[model samples]
Target chain A: MELSQAARLDQAAEVLPAALRRRVLALPAAERARIEELRLRGGRPMFLLGPEGETPLPGTEITAQTLETVLEMASRSSVHTVLDQVRNGFVTIPGGHRLGLCGTAVMDGKTLVNLRGISSLCLRVARQFPGLASEVLPKLWQDGRLESTLILSPPGAGKTTLLRDLIRCLASGLGCPPLRVGLADERGEVAAMAGGVPMLDVGQRCDVMDGCPKAVGMAALLRGMDPQVLAVDEITAPEDVQAMLQAAGCGVRLLATAHGETLADLDRRPLYRSLMADGLFDRLVLIQQTDAGRRYTVTDGEGRPC
Target chain B: MLKLLGGLLIMAGALWCGVSAVERLRRRVRVLEDLRASLVWLSEELTFRRSPLPKLLEQLARERSGPVELFYREALAGLSQDPEGGLQQSWRRAMVLQLDFLREEERQVLVEVGKTLGRYDAGAQAQVLAQAARRLETIRAQAGEEARGLGRVYTALSLAAGAALVLMLL
Candidate 1:
């Protein structure tokens, strides 16, 4: 079984200093479950970010040593191994929790070489809801094959969450026939792969290529894994679009997400507009943050609401 | 006859003491040499494979024996025992507890290396290890020279003292 939210919180807290871990664990169960991120700045009190807002834990100020310990523990006592990710501004720990770092940058001729003397860290907790896309899944298939669907939302609107669930459902054959899914998990977010095995449940039929650029990973997954569907998260680069177009040419279904609120919002951007113009996506799932919860709306490739 | 036997026993005891002292010196040199060799191996593994510390230590313990192997095993154990203390503390504690035969300066060189083992990039770690190995090499050479010179002196002194004592008794 998947770990409970409290257990995930504990796992994320394992990287924290002992005293701070205790303080975080001491929160009420209600507050613990609602925590979305853990923020720590050297010389400042620790803060817990949730849907309500930031809640500071009194009497728990961060130190430089605390940040060092967190980095050491998160990297499994090997910061050098994850130095590339650290240079990129975040490090994804086991279980897919990402630590966004703020620190002194070591640059070499306009290129970021390393991150040193870390001052603040924002640990974004990764959560999975297995059946989140069940209602939206039926509309995404035509005949026996799944449509090449694009998940659209602004940041923090649960785009990755829905995409993850959709991959799990499709790969596990929860509502449709089992499909072989090759996930180009560029940031290690989708599968949270650790030691050649996924830390999170990405279904039995999923093969993940993690911690590589999405463009390279997608092309590799297409050529090597021979997957029925190629899934990637947060399409942001031109190379990613070219790779998707190449994969589409091979008759492989594609599943991807982009940063936008609506179809019109995506069309405004030249990159996304080119993707839409190529007719690469067969359907779009627009996610909106409603007062009660998230709302997922499905539409055809031409922006006709389904 | 009794007098002769007593003289022989004194001579034998003196010889044993000399041998033991020489052996202790040789052992110190051997320990230093072994530690240097192990550092070279560590440097190669870290530089080429970028292997993590725990796995590298486990491999090291398996390949070595005596104080060098014990040192690595103790370091690995310390990691599991009190992880919050981190690798440096564990490494320093391991050296202090297990490698008592080493001189303070020799151990300090290793402690310096431990401080950076898991903290930096492979290139940096390899550079530190290389520096440590070079330092250990210089120490080992001096130790070897000391052992050869001091061993001969200890043996000659023990033999001369034994002979003088026997003559006086007679």
Candidate 2:
């Protein structure tokens, strides 16, 4: 079978330095296709993380020089264009590939402005598995409309992947009335936008506002786009919860994700605690990576199984 | 007829040597001037825009349009081929290869500029670029002074030598 345009191997290989690229290219074809991330740290062995967990790339040692080369290639030699993302600790390269950065913080009057002495990097492959949300969508929608929904999952459990599919399905009106979806992509993940263009299929009716804070983008979409459903990822900040509440108050449907395994975990966070008690969300979907793909459990706002 | 041909040949040989010597000095001056202008523009760009290194290098390659462009273009190509060498190493290799006419001091200053490039905040990078530009300005002045004297001497000496050779042949 031919490779899809989005997953063309060259895009993934571009971020790697010469030594690492050779190492990655030598992996079996199936293992190469399943690669989700390539993690590099100065003075440590390289690692490849996929669905099968982390596998170390032995005989490879990341160095300060290796990181400099990756930055040069990934940022296209322009540090200014990605300075904001650097300050935020990650950058989204072309082809919708996201690179996470870790280095010494450069402070501008107590606020983190950028990084220096960068020593660790994570190059994540942006893969879209369409229709992953098929089974979970019916639970999110009830009586022919999307309820204010929240998805919960642990880190690396495919929360963003599921969210992307869910947004596409709902916006395409899987079996219901077609509705406009406003995706406030804070970290450029949901839509994986590059040059203001959406790389992943978020659906025909989805309008995205990316590369800004989720709260700010959400508020902007709510005021300007007048979307029927607003989606955001990883709502950990109090400001994001405020924007989500404001969207709920405006009677717009909410679709969002948070870092947690169970509804009980979300109940512990103050921000989510208020959101839960106020009934801002009507449905909760929890995801766990299972042997047979991902397993999702559904419940109502009051913690009752759907 | 044979004597006349010998005289013309001697004059031609003298003219070629003299002109080639003068041209070499003049070319060095042009190189220094072009590099200085490019550095000034780079400083301004680094101050205002603070673009990423690869992007800025591509832009410089396009805008500078000569040996200056060669430096960036070669650096980009080298980085693509051997990224494990680091950005500084790639850039240094370009500078050494492309800026062969440059004095060791002038080349050293350019390599220093690479140290802070793409590795610091805008203010810091701009500061480094500005300093490099200043150093390049001084080197350009030094090259200009040397080129003016040497160019005139080589051209005058060659013309005189050609005339003497022609007279001797006659």
Candidate 3:
């Protein structure tokens, strides 16, 4: 069975050093469910970043050894195996929980070779909201074909969570005809793949290229996987836009996410503006975190509010 | 008849003691050689394939045998049993428990290998494993030499001790 949010929090905590794990797990189930991230810094009190605010766990001072042990346990004692991710300053655990690391950088001629002497770890618990795309999915289709769509949100606004559900729904044919989705999961966050199998359910027809750079994986997926849709997270690089444009040229629809609160916000960035000028995406879903809950707004390519 | 039987028993006991002494020396040499071979294989795998430590240890346990196999199996078991203690603790524990035949110096080489196995990048780990294999090779060479020399001495000493006892008794 898939784990509940609180259970996932507990599962992520399992990788923490023993004492910290116990302290984090001791929270009320309600509080555990609300936690978004866990921050542990050497010589500082550990804090749980929840929806409310940063809640510090008093008297729990993190040490360098604690950070090392957590990394060791999280990597299953194979830090060498995940050195590529370590070089990127974060390591994603099996269940898609991401551990953002802070440490002294080991460099090789302007390149980050690895991270050593870790001082802090921010563990972001990955949650699956399977039905989050239900309302947003119907609006993305025009006639029999799905439109190229882009999900927009500020960081920590559940953009990845929504993208994951959208892919699952599209591939599973929950609300639309099932399409083969080629996911370029650069950091392994979208699929949380382990040994060629996704730890999280992406869908029956989803083909994930895990831990590959978005631009390269998308091109490879387009060439080999014959995907009808290419879904990528965080369109941050120019190479990623070029790849997406190439895929769109082949009539393969795209489902991608970008860091933005609104369509206007995306237009301010030269990279996003150029992609928009190409008319690559026909639909945009902007996610806003509200007092009540998260609000999803679907807009046309022209930025007309729905 | 009783005296003849006692003499026979003395000779048989002496032969058994001599054989056992020779076997212990041979076993030590065999163990060291096997361990060195396993480390070499591990180093290659880490450098080329970059397989995870647990999976590699599992493969080592499955394909190998004797003290080398036992050592890997115990280390793998340690990881599963008490993961919070991490690989270093598990590896050190496994070495202390399973590598009793190794000299203090030989075991110390393994202990150093344990400390670096999973803590660094593939290049670093591969280098450490290669160094360990070299150290083990040196130790095994010395052990092989000693086994050839000391093995005969131990057998001969046991044989002489047994003969003298039998002579006194007779």
Candidate 4:
């Protein structure tokens, strides 16, 4: 069967495996050609064409049929699952595609149950953008070893992307000996792997526990994996703090991310506040996006410019 | 013949109530399923990549469509409109909005989720999740018992009314 236009786009970014990409792209020329044309033009053009090219783009255009098909195809080809179906309009695909669905949602108090007449879907494809860690690696390895680091960024600022690249660099030993890395991919975002193997490189030296809760995964890694460094994504819960502390206590250097626009943003959050107060992380890295590109800034635990 | 007419009326009423109750239950189940799916999505987005929590939360809020959208919208509004209110205040407002829509058990689960997001600790978050799961189990058991009781009552009422009508006719 022919892959949908969204699958084609995912293939281009290498989010879809090579074998699957070929299978998806190898359909009859007419269908493949249509998706290729749309892929070349990007999300906006494909969106403009609408499903079956019958009508103008509605406010929310993803249909239930489209979502179900895409999801089923992705799941069949990959090891990921559908984690959540948002009532307002989104289906959280396991390998990190937040397919924004457009529909009317039925609500019971604060919780939503069903979405009817899905109109549009924005499939946010997840990719591990490499080459970022090279810039920050030197700063992190102060004395010929990896230092405990904290990555800070606003949403979509690419903290996970950078961390993934860092893990790859450290694990593969791009230039140096491979380092054993433990990745607690609590959300299945980092590896974006289908089964056990990662769709993204994320380095050869890293052992990943996908979809496991962060704390349990971390403790497991410490006890079982014996990783040289421990990495996790977004720390917001107080329990996550305790886990990080526990990992630190185990003598495993920490690498993680937190939400904040600036160092001052850290002061307002209790978890970040306590981590900062305790001086848990040896180095703090800030990422900011600009028209030029993503800029990285290094800082100490005290939030001083490094 | 008069007695038969009364029996028919009673049967009609019972069927009507039965269908209505079934429909209500179905709707509730659908809502719960959707909410559960959304929660899974929330967990994925929050834990997947290392996006900053506030930024991620704001993005989620912007992308929110269902009932929880309001919570996200309020969080976004609080962040943008009341920058001085601080993260805690913004978070609290969002949680409050969420609490309004959630069942008591779901609300408790969210409170713990909020706490986990506020801090960067994984173990603590896991603990809260385990506790919430336990509470959910209790709620499910109670709901099951209540549903069973309701079903029995419905069956008894239908049978008793049918029997009484037959006797009156005889």
Candidate 5:
């Protein structure tokens, strides 16, 4: 089945507490499909955020008991299985749906040992959009060599959505040769690999390493998969950039996304200074989505608009 | 002819009582053994497969029979359907309503494990299960000894009581 068709929002609703499950079911099918997230906090009203905005779910108040049950169900009655994800404040279930959690942090001398008394929960829907990266593909290919690209966007601007398609199309010979694409999905969001299988279609040539740090995953991809192109989402750490540089030096193309509006955002960061000074990115793409519509702008590494 | 018939009738009744007493003892022992074996399987399932409670229980319910199967089926139904109550409460209810083989104390051990079953990570849950499995082994041993002792005593007593009653009647 097509990955987009297979990534169902109902997967999240199915694991919800029974009382809220009814409310989720009551939502119109189209609205349900458009939901970006479902947030529930103990003693607070449940809310669903979509393209338009937040809609408070009436008569659906999250209770402590209910929140505990949701965590139990999401973790499959075994907290150890999802302990690493839990420590990171989110757990990825089957079908690539992620449940964000916040609770009393059990700390052992500054390191978070685990979570207890969990009270806040958010279920983010991971989805795929076919052909969403068409506008940027041409800009990335020049002289028969695909340029390493970096996607830029603010929160809720569809950067991950666009990047997912970019990885899919590029992996399937959309622009250059059908190269081996290695995805370092730290949060399992890009490829949504569940049980070592991509829930979303990332093309036939894509190999994914999920649930690891971007830096570690990038290195593993370089050494293990020997991929020609490596993709990672949300590169925020120094280690991630170092790995990207190392992989690029090895002749592996890099695709990375970050929380930013433009190249100016990267220039402001001390961590990405050397990366920008090196002219590492061949093509820079900025995505903006507002009430008007979604727009994609392509630029060169020197910040000149294409 | 009438006295002879009466004596034979008494002897037949005594033998039946002896056999019936032995059967109940054997059933109790068999139930304890089944419970221990099922618990061993449960530990293996948790250690190796790490399936969720409902799925694991469903699998066991399908493959097994007798008292252990009943417990798994009841626990599965309660867990899948009970949203109002915690799994511990559901487990207790299922034990009370469905499983008849276990003593109240032995059943309490299973219920106690349910209290932490889904509340923590897999490693912790597996640890709890392994302890419960060990406890189950101990219970099974005790039950075996009890059955061996009780089976012989009850059978002999029942037969002797029947025979003495027949003599008094004569």
Candidate 6:
């Protein structure tokens, strides 16, 4: 049956298996648009379609009430368990759409007990922006060895998208002995796997462990996987800092990302604090979106002229 | 005339009881509503940049004034004391203590989240969060229903007490 966009979205919502449904419904308008766009680009089905401030679900506004409902539910569940639910929370109804979450935390000292009052949510529609990585891969590798690099950008700046493409490029071996790549996709953002298999083709040479902690995963890769380079995303935690240091000590090149609009943003984070104190990373790559399109600049750890 | 005077006194006592009951119910509702509202704010803070999860949780633990505040306190206590033991252990222990207060699915989700965080890999962590989110939809739907049910019960009880007061006056 040919489904209309709204119908497709409705069907997707209906099949979202309960947990994902709430997250999707709670997404802000802008985030929903992004998800729709990604889904269309990826040729995946879109589970949600409607104008801003008007969705099918009642009381599903991107307000405190809805946010509280979502968080309360999350708090009752485990972080890992809820993340998995978020992964499966959508169906490729027609435009390959997906939803993501952002929220407040209830902390006990340094531990996150529960996430409450979810505020912003992004619904990225998954699209396979193929050939995007080809341009960047050549610049990232030299003499067949991967460089220790850091990808920087603000949220929705295509950092994960770029990383995903890079993983695929490395995994394909680009006509060389396949690079054994270990992707520590902490948020399932890079690989987007379903049922233990990658929904996206990250490449045959890649080994993924879905829902594992980044620090532990890096250590494991170094000890067991024997990869030439280790890649992870969005490193912020102190433990993550410790893990990355351990990886660098083992001589494994590293690639990662942090939330920042510019180099200055990088300086304020604990991750940056470690980077300066430890000098662990070799190159810092800055990605920016200008009218000319996506631009890239590679600099040394100090942000000095390369 | 004496009998009528006694009847009037009894009616006044019943009226007082009715008003007090209504006030009590209203207060409880307000407390629950406030808790719900605070939870929403806390959720938003967690996702905001420049604010890490641990810091936010600690703030909430210190400032919260409800039953959930204890959960926050335990989490903060666990995290600050053992910064090296790993965040998952503290979260699990604190969350488990309040597991009985949560819905069954929520309890299961928390348990799984703790386990997932213990592993090594971003993909795994993402998957765990995704799964927990899925279950959360169900839990939210059910919670909404539960909240509504409680509201209805309060209303009914208030109405019944008011009616009893009126009968006593008659």
DockQ of each: 0.65, 0.37, 0.76, 0.01, 0.39, 0.02
Q: What is the lDDT of residue A62 in candidate 4?
A: 32
Clashing pairs in 1: none
Interface RMSD of each: 1.3, 2.6, 1.2, 15.9, 2.8, 12.5
Ten consecutive residues with minimal summed lDDT in candidate 2 chain A?
Answer: A1-10
Q: Which candidate leads the pack in TM-score? A: 3
In model 6, the runs with Cα more than 4 Å from the true position are A1-80, A83-112, A115-120, A175-177, A302-306, B1-170
What is the docking quality class of candidate 3? medium
lDDT of 2 at B163: 84
Better of 1 and 4 by lDDT: 1
DockQ of 2: 0.37
The estimated TM-scores of all candidates read 0.91, 0.83, 0.95, 0.50, 0.85, 0.48
Worst-scoring 10-residue span by lDDT in model 1 chain B: B78-87
lDDT of 2 by residue, B29-132 (tens): 77777777766776777778665566667787888767877988998788667655656788899988898877789888888887767666677777877788
List, residue by residue over A1-306, the lDDT tens digit for candidate 6.
223333333433432324446566566645543333212111122234332222343333344543433332222222333434343332121222344554566576986554444554444544445567676666666676677878888765677777777777777876345687888866566676655777666787887754567888887777888877788988878888888888888888787887787778766876677675688776777788777667877777777645
Chain B structural similarity as TM-score, candidate 5: 0.87
Q: Pick the candidate with the highest lDDT.
A: 3
Q: TM-score for chain A of every candidate model?
A: 0.95, 0.92, 0.95, 0.72, 0.93, 0.68
Give the per-residue lDDT of model 5 (tens digit) for B1-56. Answer: 99879988987888788788778777767766776677677667767876666677
Instruction: Assess candidate 5 and give its lDDT.
Output: 0.80
Model 3, position A53, has a per-residue lDDT of 71
Comparing only chain B with the true structure, the TM-scores of all models are: 0.93, 0.87, 0.96, 0.51, 0.87, 0.53
Predicted structure with the largest DockQ when compared to the true one: 3
Task: Select the stronger candidate by lDDT from 1 and 3.
Answer: 3
lDDT of 4 by residue, A36-118 (tens): 11111112322322224332222323334444434333333111123233432444354554455555676769877555444
Whole-model lDDT values for every prediction: 0.89, 0.81, 0.90, 0.62, 0.80, 0.58
Off by over 4 Å in 2: A1-14, A33-52, A55-124, A173-176, A220-226, A249-251, A290-293, B1-23, B44-48
Fnat per model, in the order shown: 0.62, 0.54, 0.82, 0.00, 0.49, 0.00
